[model samples]
Target: MDTNDKHYRNPEAVLDLYERPPLATWPLLSLQHLFSMFGATVLVPLLVGLDPSIALFSSGIGTILHILITKGRIPAYMSSSFSFIVPSVALMKTAGYAGVAQGTIAVGLVYLVVATIVGIAGSGWIDRALPPIVVGPIVIVIGLSVASSAADNAMMNGKHYDLTYFGVAIFTLLVTVLFNMYLKGFWSNIAILLGIVCGYVLSVALGIVDFSKVISTPWLKLPAFEFPYISYTPKKIYWDAILSFAPIAFVTMAEHLGHIMVLDELTHRNFFKNPGLHRTLAGDGTASIFAGLVGGPPITSYGENIGVMAVNKIFSVYVIIGAAVFAALFGFVGKLSALIQTIPGPVIGGISFILFGVIASSGLRILVDNKVDFNRKRNLMIASVILVIGIGNAYLQIGSFQFTGIGVATVMGILLNLILPREALSEE
Candidate 1:
């Protein structure tokens, strides 16, 4: 039969795969993709003391929603965003978990607004508004802002720098690095998971792990789901929290565009032109809203899954669909959720140390890759001010509302980029 005739008989066969691999390969491929994103997805919820199961479930639903929204064209997985970690933690302290959810929903709304604008106009304005000068520092702040939290966790909630916990953290970090750098194929992809397992074992031997919760937990139970609006009333709403966290969406929006660009290079397809920025942004925004409603972390495109696709040469959207199914299914197992919660604080801390550092480094790479002129007075002024504001946790209050650290820095960077004269931006 001709290629066209064969494709007609099996519509899925002709989609993106070079050749339709066997059904047996699908699960394994899906699992690989899941493994790649597993560490980061679980870490976000763990950091904020949320249910990892809910995050996993929300991510699966969000990924599926994104696929449906984009007509299954773009190959991306939606998962908890680290960008929300610092703000979510801060907001949770003042506004409570419900407040965090409300703020997150506000951020998702921002995405919808931006998506609407992109739908009407093109993505050019997004680039103009958030040049590398603006985005690079914001990304750095997103990571650096939380650096102390990692250290605090490593010290067992700031008790002190005990050698035992520090030792465990270092071991986990080394294991993850070794697996990622030296391993090949499947082993390499699961480096982070393997590192966690090794760290968990060490923690157990050191008598740090608490298994009582795991034993008491049921094997099968529904996820602990919470609704944002229903859980909190207007009187309890922290408008300041909403204002502070919502603008982070602008950072993630730029990140979404970067992810699409990476996918385009990996798949050799112009996803931006095909799925179009509007569809992708809208899909992401909708997914984030869903996640927020369920009291899960905000969703963003998974770079880990993108890395999986790049390594395996598998670009099939169905693989991501299968992974999403697995994630959602795992969310229903109460024992699995309990087990995740049982993970020692130090183990999370160690992994986070690496993860947060990687985030900061990625920001640096963005500036380097884009050839951003740091020597220029304009760039230096913008970057330096952002770093100070974010790292110093400089908080600005207007009435009852407040902008903290990253929020204030992000606004400053954007405004500076816009207000600075071009001629004054000359190279040093």
Candidate 2:
């Protein structure tokens, strides 16, 4: 069927189109998307010691690039992927930022190859290969695997856990929940951002916020852009770093698929069939490559933005475009970046508790929504093993290479679903 035929069949989807929303509401909705993704996007750079402004800048450019590539049909925001955090940090320590950049480029290349294969072979194979039994558990792993990081940050105070930090974190969490539940319209849509603002204020009141950096930073300044080859010292490629990080592309590819599936379910649109999964994958890959070359984190479709879309029901492509533009503009504001850095860890921790849990809950919802038969031994086994391995942080190592909790769980779930016999126990 033609794209126009598809659009005519689903009238509701027109609301999410670029021209539907009033021009005045565009910025506000865009702000909601930006705020929804800001906490996590900035956190990636903070964790890996990359410049947050550059990350934000790249995210903006990457997202715009994605929208352009996808013909603005998919209403997804591209940002830093959490999957790259561990490898990126390790690469920085071992081979420096240049190596990390190269590794990220390698990952993008892997995505491009996968996209090419999917484009030729079609997405029908994907459905038979990864049903809800496999996809649901992998989604759960994506969220639960990083659960501990939230707790660690919430309780952290330099070297030890602090009651004050916990108190602030709880306060932030409460604010977010309250706003999300009680507020209406724009306020409800920006609950997380509001919570962060409140938490930041509380932290400043408690003397935990260091203003020295913000005070010194200029109002208007460009992001410290780092090019792949030109920015590196010794000016050479690191094949070892590239190889080490390249394997992670397998994991992220699975994650990319999961994101598309979740989005399909949420939007009630067949994204896999519309733009075709190949285009989406290619768009994401192109964004990642651009980000890597610019010394930013690997970009992907953000789950956090997905959560916001679930809540607000505003999926206009123009809204995301506005957000992307704002993000890029913010990157040029030196003081704005500094101020974001000054936000205490606990505040981020508190917001993460909600965001990550939202992801986990979404996975559960997908299973329930699809009516996956857990009574079956095959289904039960797949779900149980995936959750345990992922949450338990199991790892498999082979010489210099390693598979993380989510990675191992994703691979195992797919293998189990493929090998195990298909049978459902009859209802008693």
Candidate 3:
């Protein structure tokens, strides 16, 4: 057999075979990716006390906007980011539900500003000022710091049980790690799905999952129309959420750069050089802007789905477009979101363990790609400051505004990067 026959040489062909599949194949692939990301999409709404259907609907529409902004060149799926989940929880606790609503609306506007910044300065300028020194460690911090809570929850089975959920979580995590590392072909791509299946089985056997909610949920119903702006109280715009999340758009913009790079590698085309980073950045911004407007959470291009496209070698943007259409349709169906919510926690967590890790690793890859010299004093300083401030919840107060978490870290990194001069002794 020819080498090309044994392994698909064309990215489009591989995508056709495995990743860039048409509408007919979307149900399975979309469902699989959906499960991996569903917890994140729902968690924000549940915690912030917003309607989950709106989140789902916005996510669907956001993906469409992203595709349109990029002129349907990039094949990536936009979804919820877990980074916002705990923040949403904190916003609710500190400022009440109304405060969270106002804060989220304000946060959406931040995305618009970031999009505008990219539009004005152009994409090349973004790389010069921010670079990997600022972006890499911050992403590592984003993953590890945000993960502490999940790890803690996994260890404690509420107040009553001990070590049971911990064991299950560990088992789930191990399966994800092993499968992603060792498994190949379709198995690798579906590792999260399989791991979730195993975790669900165990949860059922242990009687940990309550199926009553699933049973009681209606099979079909119109999505509850959530007027997110309805809850927007001007007095309740918590400065903490506004300051803390707004600057995060910077790091998120860096994250978009990584996604574009991966797509370029998968497609064997420097997408940035053509339809370009500027176009993709505009796409991301538009997605975020439109998503926010529709009472949806902020949308980011999913690296996991890009990996799916890379592995499958399906390069047709239409496939992703079709996926977007499906997501949009499903968003209007309350039963769809409800059905996903019915999945056992451990199962969802099992999938999250894999996907989230992949997200963090993608950030590290950015640092590596830039060949950041960690040994240098300037580079080390930038990396250290960003990671600490980002993960340690470093905060600053100026008059009525409060800056903390990723927001604080992003601003700090950008300043340090610009101020710190390159070494006199330059080496190639």
Candidate 4:
């Protein structure tokens, strides 16, 4: 009677630091993570005029490097960092794709420098710098900042709302929400995956999917890898490219800190100390370098994948590695990649609707769970600034490189936390 079916496993079971699901279920579990990250990962490169296939290939390798560098503890999935999009796009006009790639490598070097320091000095300062008051709002900002992107996918049709697509999105969101809340055993963990499948099927029924993409793409093809120059040449000093990317590393590092804080709050573990911030930073840096070498956007920790982990309560690094393998392999399989791309925008939107909201709610949970006193004037100010700047999508630019949205909010939150006065770790 197949009593050993993975479906029979407890729905509420958590796969934590060292835990894993049954071997048979690993691929399904891993595919959900891939689905969770796929849209945004590909979208970044598309928006910036890089090949999506290369982005997939590089992100796959980068995530693997991340898992290895982190000592296989944190289940973070690295993807194209949204942080560098603006500057990279701008640099592309003057310096071309080569310049963007160089800037990305510089960003990697910046991460390495920070990683070395964090490794030597310890992460106690990170704890002090990103207290819940500061971190909670920033994380909220991080999650909510992308709300429009999700909403656009789920509901918008061109410039106007499309009733048909909206219905599909709503249906997808409903299915995912119901499974998350009511489903039992192993099924509950894959609500997002199930939701995406359901939505895709409905989209197919409605004739929204174009079969041409799958038909036109070849069965197998190699992604174009753009290699970077390792040395300063006679023709170019390359300082401009370096300048374009290096400063933002500090900004995105702060974003990474907010991401770690969310992870800690979600898993109830101090990732900042255990695997250590140094390792995470190093992992992210290596990812960026690898991605840049392959002519992809600088890879950074993705909140979408974090939201998936938070919902599923599955933090197994093996699942992460499995997803990485799929990503890496998908890059070589043109038809398969095209098939995945054929997934309707509404389907992605519907899933993101709940996924992004889950992340935003996590930040609020940190505040409530930690009992961060909003009554305190300083805490109020910190949270307020972060929320407004982040949610408002504000950017502060200095020279060619500037902190955008999440970066600005993160830096502001940290500065406020550092400068603000407090009697003790807890208020009176």
Best by lDDT: 4
- Ranking, lDDT, top scorer first: 4, 2, 1, 3
Q: RMSD of model 1, in Å? A: 6.6
lDDT of 4 at 349: 88
lDDT of each: 0.74, 0.80, 0.62, 0.85
lDDT agreement of model 4 with the native: 0.85
Give the per-residue lDDT digits (tens) of candidate 2, residues 286-310: 9989998888988888877776666
Residue ranges of candidate 2 with Cα displaced over 4 Å: 1-25, 46-49, 85-97, 228-236, 424-428
**Per-prediction tally of clashes:** 0, 0, 8, 1
Alpha-carbon lDDT of model 1: 0.74
**Best-to-worst TM-score order:** 4, 2, 3, 1
Candidate number of the best TM-score: 4
Deviating ranges (above 4 Å) for candidate 1:
1-55, 71-110, 157-160, 224-276, 292-323, 399-404, 425-428
Error of 3 at 115 (Å): 2.9
Root-mean-square deviation of every model: 6.6, 3.2, 5.9, 5.1
Span of ten consecutive residues with least summed lDDT in model 2: 3-12
lDDT of each residue in 221-319, candidate 4, tens digit only: 888777655422224545787887888888888778878888877766777887899999999999998887778998888888888888888877788
Estimate, for each residue in 138-218, the C-alpha lDDT of model 1 and write its tens digit: 767766777887777677645666888888888988997898789876566456667778999999999988888789988
Q: Worst 10-residue stretch by lDDT in candidate 1?
A: 4-13
- Tell me the tens digit of each residue's lDDT in model 3 across 1-428: 33213233443454532235544555565555556556667776776666677777777777778777766666778876544555666766777554444445555566666556656766675466557687676666555555655555466555544567777777777886687679886566556666767776787788877766657766665555535456344464467876666655555665566566555544555555456666676676666656555555666776556544443345556666665666677676656656667665555544555554654665677788778887788898888888888778776655534454666787788888887778635532
